[model samples]
Target: MKMAPKGNDVIVSDRKLEMILSMKGGNGEASYANNSQAQAIHAQSMLHLLRETLDNIQLMEPPSETIPFALADLGCSCGNNTLYIVDVIIKHISKRYEASGYEPPEFSAFFSDLPSNDFNTLFQLLPPIGSSMEECLASDTHRSYFAAGVPGSFYRRLFPTRSIDFFHSAFSLHWLSQVPESALDKRSMAYNKGKVYIHGANEHTANAYKKQFQTDLAAFLGARSKEMKRCGSMFLVCLGRTSADPTDQGGPGILFGTHFQDAWNDLVQEGLITGEKRDSFNIPVYASSLQEFKEVVEANGSFVINKLEVFKGGSPLVVKQPDDAAEVGQALANSCRSVAGVLVDAHIGDQLSEELFKRVERRGSCYAKELIEQLQFFHIVASLSFA
Candidate 1:
């Protein structure tokens, strides 16, 4: 099995965010469009909600550039996904402007993620979107400038004062870098070891996670307060732990336990590794309870929650496998080609890469087999606006 480098071996570019949009000699759209189905549903739902929310509020007769309307897709993994969402928002705004006889406000978009992201890849994908959208909105003569990689913590600086209008994040924010070391210092081995943390383990992990989340939530709100114009909206699509208790094998969250268990068993069965120490590799993400999520959102002053939905087991966003598993596997392989490059760069051996993919295939297959139930839950997508 490949060994992850000491320290944060996972860099943003290495995670395939860059090459997702381009791969010579590959099915370009298929490779980059894994989230297309989910994102389409989200974009439609979000735009409708936004319009409905704004129906009651009357804007001044003349639209002014000073009151620019903006939207951000934070933790925007693929620039392609960002493009799709932008198309939806722009289209909606344009339709509204036409019906109401008002010129649409210029849009400034922010695509933010960690500093390690592949901005080069993101830049390459943006031109086509801009050109196409510019053509469509030519009558409006509105300008859309695509900004590449606002690098930093989403929980911190991703924009300037009073700049953002609408914000959206998808499938991110659950994975914090590491357990806050200070909070974990007093915990015991069984709890910290990342097992079936029934009682002591569950309570300890939850408390520590909540603390970090609160700190991060405060920072996120603080930054956005300075960045968002009054009454601007935000939509956060992220993961969460479904259950408060860890004892139930199917206790929602991104089942790190299930993923680790399968990974460990595979490594052991292949005779490439040994021991239970693999549990030590547990990535401590703060998958808070729903109430905890609500608490943090309310605590943040600049924003007011508009809508929050739980997609449990599966939702419209869940990707379904094609009838042919082989085709699905191939799609996944192409999509993950850059990830293989990252693995090799991290010194994970080629033989191990093949084995890892096999494990992933089997896991995906298992999930598909049980499609009627337990396809993993996306914790929530909270819609918010400037208070």
Candidate 2:
């Protein structure tokens, strides 16, 4: 079994820290605890890029220094995402090793997230598979260490300089807990209700977002530059917008951008929350126009773009309710369980959450049926490597 680092009060790994922090304040909206269909698809794309990149790399000749082959999943929150990404890397590497008639490099996998994530939830799910990280401690396949709960904001200093071989970040970086509140100020035209474009109004807001992105991008690359071996590869898949228009939307067809706004409105109309509370909460996600994302990567000196692809990241979850109120109520209860904390914090309260369900039940299945049809999301994936 992989052991925790000595002297650390929190036993979580670095990657797990990234995941947890990404999940903090999610309460119900973006909890990693709830499985999304996009997880597997994102994993597949990451694995594909990793395999291709690894195949093209030229291993050093004998008498050379030892090159530690490592893979890290940044913002790999708790639940299936962390494990799924890890499995993809392992499977891809194994396939290439067998085909080339060469021994596989030693593998060290890192799972990073924020300090607030559930490390135990992730640790408990580590696969006890053959020649896995645990088994590699004694065998030759590779030594895989499952470290948990390492903070992701420390991306610049994430790993030992030049120590990583392969890296991946999925569905995590889009969230910047520190995004300025002004970015969401509706009066500024920077954001319209349900609109997600960054044009017009305050140049300062845009610049602030830009500055953070630039700093984070630089830190991310710089940190990886130190930790990655020469010619190492990295893949980053994040939630992004294909359009520059705030109204343009994509992603899982069910949870469209409108649904988010609608849900917020629901809470507001019920007198369970206030505008001040809404203003305080900012989902620090910027759906980068392809141009915006490229500019950020180009500004960072250490890495070069290999393949940049924008693809679908989520599917609509069809919510079907029975004509009867009782069964329909149960379904709504289960759906909101992950988001209950946020709802209560918004002043809906625990008792209110239940009452809200009852309200949905009273509206009958028609309103619930209409809700599932309207929500959707969008995303993008970019693959890069050390220059």
For each of the candidates, give the backbone clash count: 4, 41
Worst 10 residues of 1 by lDDT: 18-27
Candidate 2 per-residue C-alpha lDDT over 1-387 given as tens digits, one digit per residue, 9 for 90 to 100: 233432211122323222333342332433546534445655564565656666655554433324445677777666766776676675566556546665555556777776665666776767553554336435434325435456546455777777767777877655553455456566653443332223332455556565665566666666777877776787777666666643333442123233343455565576665545444343444555566678777877677787776766543232344344444433433333332333222333345444544444444344554444443345567777777
lDDT string, candidate 1, 329-365, tens digits: 4433333333222322232345554565566556645
For candidate 2, report its TM-score. Answer: 0.71
lDDT for model 1: 0.52
RMSD of each: 6.1, 8.4
TM for candidate 1 is 0.72
Q: Best candidate, lDDT-wise?
A: 2
Q: How far off is residue 257 in model 1, in Å?
A: 3.0
